[model samples]
Each structure stands twice: as C-alpha cells, then as structure tokens.
Target: MYVAVKGGERAIEASYRLLDAARRGDPAVPELQVGQLQQQMRLLVDRVMAEASLHDPELAALALKQAQGDAIEAVFLLRAYRSTLPRFGYGEPLDTARMRASRRICAVFKDVPGGQVLGATHDYTQRLLDFGLLCPDAGHAVIQAASGAPVPDAMPSALAALAAEGLIEPQRPSAGDPEPPDITRVPPSYPLPRTARLQMLARGDEGWVLGMAYSTQRGYANTHPFAGEVRVGHVPVEIVPDELGFPIEIGEVELTECQMINQFTGSADVAPQFTRGYGLAFGRSERKTMAVSLVDRVMRADEFGEDRTSPSQDQEFVLPHSDNVEASGFVQHLKLPHYVTFESELQLIRALREAWDARTTVPPRSVEPSTKEVCAK
Candidate 1:
C-alpha cells in the first residue's frame, strides 16, 4: 500500500527514466532508424496504420519504434496523435474498379480475365525457414526478387463476370442513402448499419478479426464462401474542394481489397444468387483483409435471413470487443490501485466469517424437554 500510494510523483519520474534506459539498450549498438522500420518492418507499420485509421507510414514507423515494437501500444500512440491533427475534409469513396492491381487472384474461377498474378506472395514457398537468410545479402536478394515483377495491364474482377450472368446479387444504396455515422466522433448504439459495422471492423484488431473469421470457417456460422477475388494495388483518392464543384485526384494509397462470394439460396421474395462480402484496408494486408471479408459475411446473417446463433454473428459481441486499444486499456487497468474497493469487500468477508463461526460454535440450544417426554419419564 505504501509503494502503491505514497510513491506518487517521484516514483513515476524514476519509472520513466528506467523505461528510457531499457529502450536504448546497449549504447554500443547503433540505434534503429525510422526508415529501417518503415522499409524492413513495413507489415507492422501497415497493421498499426490500419488499426489507428491513419495512413502515414513514417508516423506509424516512429510510433512502433517509440513503443519498442509493442503493436497495440504503437496503435495507441498513433491514434492519440491523430486526434490532435486538423481534418480538412472527407475524401470520396475510392473507385477500386480502376485500380492498378499488382497482385490479383481468384480461387473460384479457373481463369480470370487477366489470369492470376502472384506478385509478391510467400504463399507458394515452402514453409521451412532458409538459414541462408542469416546472411544479410541473402535476405536482400529474396526481397529484391519480389520487386519489379511484371503486372497485368487490365486486372478485372471475377465477380463482375458472375454479376453479368445474373448469378450474383447486386447491392444498391438505402433509400435516401443517409450519411454513415462516424463511430469515432459519436458512440455507436446497437443495431448498427452495414456501413458503421464495416468501419468498426476495419479499424479493429487484426488478430481478433482473424479469429472471428476462423470461427465461421470452423462451422460456428453457416457461411459457405469462396475467394471471389483478392487484389492488391494502388487507388487514387479524390476529394472535392469546398471551393471547387467537382472532384480532383489528391494522391494514391496502397490498398488490399477482398471480395468473398457467399452462397445465398434466395428467400421467398427473391431468386437464388451469390451474395458478396467485402474487405478493404489501408495497405497490403491480405491476411487481415481476407479475415475481415469473411467476418463481414458472418456479421450480415440477420439481413440475409440466416440464423444468428454463432458468436461471429453477434454484432454486440464482435464490434465492441474488436478494438485492441480499448480492450488493452480496460484489462491493464486491473494493475492500478483499488484499495478502497478491496477494503470494502474485505470488511464484508470478515463480517460474514464471524457470523458463520458464531453459528457453528454455539452449543445446541438445550430446549426444555418436551412436555410429553417429561411426562413419560
């Protein structure tokens, strides 16, 4: 109790010093540059950016370095910084149909319009680790091989072909198409719209989303899906300036987009057609995007007349718990002092124990012999 309460300002200042020393490690070693993190640990940077909902690679790398590579901590730092930045205006939805795709594939189709382009995946490689990578040149050579590969001129979606044949269900905007609510600006209530749910899941922890998606695959949810198309590329962002009446290309952002074709036997009102689940993320995170897409389908159970019995199908269970930052803060709060609350419980337990001991220790009350027994004696 003394350490927990009385240490106060001096203790915190000392702890900060200790942390700084720990982060620096051996002074003999050269400190890691931010560019090294951005280039070498780019995947981590991408994850942090997506979770934080910020698109700055350099800032994400800096956050990762500051947190000593603790991903959730990096996300927390980045998100906090993002809150301080001024917002200019919202960008319009990206036209992904015209994306300059670098990596494109379709599991459902034997041959897509432009054929499968395996740009930079480790998917086909043997799972065994190559000890050759212990040499610096070997690692560089491996990455260099993946660079400058030929890409398709016109990589088209396989789902578009299906939709043309009326085998796919089309999505139309809601009546009046009201603007989607921003969860960061306003807290979300239950029965969230599709747009809001998508926003929440995209900003969710990657691991949690993956687990939820895996649950659906393991028969937790009745979702029969195929990888309709998975594409990675850069798409131009357009924004209409307040002064200008029309849109203008701002800049290009790297993205990974996934479309999952789900089996949907139509309800009474409609004919049977393939439904779609979509996932799009800030950078080339195929694993994260695929998981998000699968879960997206599971989360739409109610709308598609499917059972809401699975954990993946419960919006309340998924949306609120998906954020690692919020979850980490809450779970880590247990380390903080709860002296008053614990003391109250301790007194209660002490009183209860005393009552129990008194009840058990008391000699059985010797009642006067029953009148009938006395008479008999």
Candidate 2:
C-alpha cells in the first residue's frame, strides 16, 4: 500500500526553476542590476573581489547576482571565472605611494605630509536602525561641505619614509637567485616563502583572518603591533607588452595596504631594530589588510626576537588554513554519503558489547586448588 516515489529529476529541475524565480522576484519591481549592486552593495562587492583575488568590480557584481547575494558563493563564482583568465604577464610591484588614495591614515603620525583622509568611511555613523528609511514617504536631503579643493600629489609611503630615516627595519630584496614558490601551482610547505604567505592572506576569508589576528591580541602570542599605515585606493597596474618590450598601462585595480610596526626585543649582542609587518590585498579591504598585517607580525616572532610558542606565530598554521575554498569544500564534503564508515563502527560497538555481556554473565569458574596444595597432594 506504499505510494511509489517518482519524478526525482523533474522535482530537482522544478526546484531550480523556483529558485531562479525567487532570485528574480517580480518583474514589476525592476530587477537588481549589476551597477546597482556595485554602487549600493559596495562593501559586499569589495569583499567578494578581495577574497576572489580578482580586482574587477563588474565581475564581482555579476558573481553576486548569480549567487543570489551570498558573499561566499559570489567569491567562489568570481574565483572560478578568474581561473579561466589567461595570465598575460606579471606587473611591476605596486607602488603604494603612487596610489590615487580614497582613504589613508597613519596611527603613528598625526601630521604627516598627506594629512589623514578619512574619505567615505562608516566609522563615525551611529549604529541605530533608521525606521524612517523604511517609510515609503521618506525624502532625501542634501548637505553641503566645502568642495573644489585640488587633489594633493601622492605622498611618500609611510614605510618608505621610516626606512629612509633608518628608524625601521628595511626589507632587502630576496637573497641570491632563489626561485619563489608559486602558491597557485604548488602546495605551500613549511617555512613558506613570503610571496606564498602574501598570496594566502590576500585571498583568505576575512572573518577567518580576523579571528586568527584577534587570537594574537588575546595573549596567544607576544605581539605588540601598531598600525603604522592603512591605505585604500586605485593603483595602476602596468605590464610590459611582449612585442612592444616597453611597459604599457594595462588597467587599474583597487587595493588596500597595511603596514604595521612591531617592537623588537633583540637577543643579547643583537642590536634592537623596529620590525615591519606588511599586508596587501586586491580590492578595497582595510579590515583584511589590517588583520593580515597583524598576523604577519605575529608570524615574524623568530626573526624579530620573540618566542614562537603560539599557533598564530606559526606560518604553517596560518597559511594552510586561511583559504575559504579549501576549508568549505572539505567541510561540505562531509555532508555527503558516509554510511559505510558508520556501519563499520556500529558493527565494532555491537561486537564489543556482546563480548562484555558474555564475560560478565558467566559465573566465575570455581577456584582451582592452589598449586601448592595440588603439589602436596
């Protein structure tokens, strides 16, 4: 009398259709355009671009739309698309000093050459919900501020300035001609190259990186880092055309750079020098950059004369676990069929229980005569 199961494929297709319909919503209510998302959902777009390691905002918006506004899924989509893009050539190392900065600040200095520009930030706004915005009759008002001031020339990067004065540690170009490990092509190893570390942090999940960074602050490690500089802006990416042999301005990318200064308690006979920590990521991601910079500082414990006793200070611990793609895939795969392993464990439990029951229920064998008594007999 059991009803027959039917229409598995049809049901799945119908479900997909329903999902699509839901994603699109009513035709009367104009569809959410990519541009709308880019302009309005800027933070979400920025996050997707950052995690995807791709700087194209339009592609991020498309991924966002296709993912139905799921940020992680959007990043996955963008990452998948980015993989298909052909690698033309490597660009010159980005010059943070040349960035057309949207926002720039230095915690160490209050009156640097380029005064702190807190441009387009949500930092000062009240967190209270605005019920008025929900009203259909809500109207917008415009306020005026002084305008028309000339955009200032790009200022010297804070790190460069510090290095110039010999107050902070300087990063020497990689010694000898050792080949740098490419994270995209090879699995990262212990004592990872700086390039690999940077790649992992740049594409790492924001929340995960932040949590690891937070652990350091919560006494997991002996890191006292000051945010020396945090800047977000569009920097031009130049490439040398193969045929032309001269560098050509390919395009511009939005980027966030964070530089941190850590105290160096040098070992005996070693001169104390200020240690540097650096983080650079694709797209505007100040939070990720700051978190990564802190992590970078924590990871430099051995080099900077601190003990590497905590997980945060271990390079292998941080880089391998940073990728959301790898983490999510492994986690979600557990949801699939695992009945075989479960059945095996169940059989073992049953056998163990039966053995225990048999041993306990059997009356103790009558004690045999002592060996000494038997021998005497």
lDDT of 2 by residue, 61-97 (tens): 9999988998888988888898899986688777767
Q: List ranges where model 2 is wrong by over 4 Å.
A: 1-8, 25-29, 135-148, 159-161, 177-179, 268-270, 359-377
* Candidate 2 C-alpha error for residue 126, in Å: 2.1
Error of 2 at 111 (Å): 0.6
lDDT of each: 0.88, 0.81
> Which ten residues in a row are the worst by lDDT in model 1?
140-149
TM-scores across all candidates? Answer: 0.92, 0.86
Off by over 4 Å in 1: 1-4, 143-149, 361-377
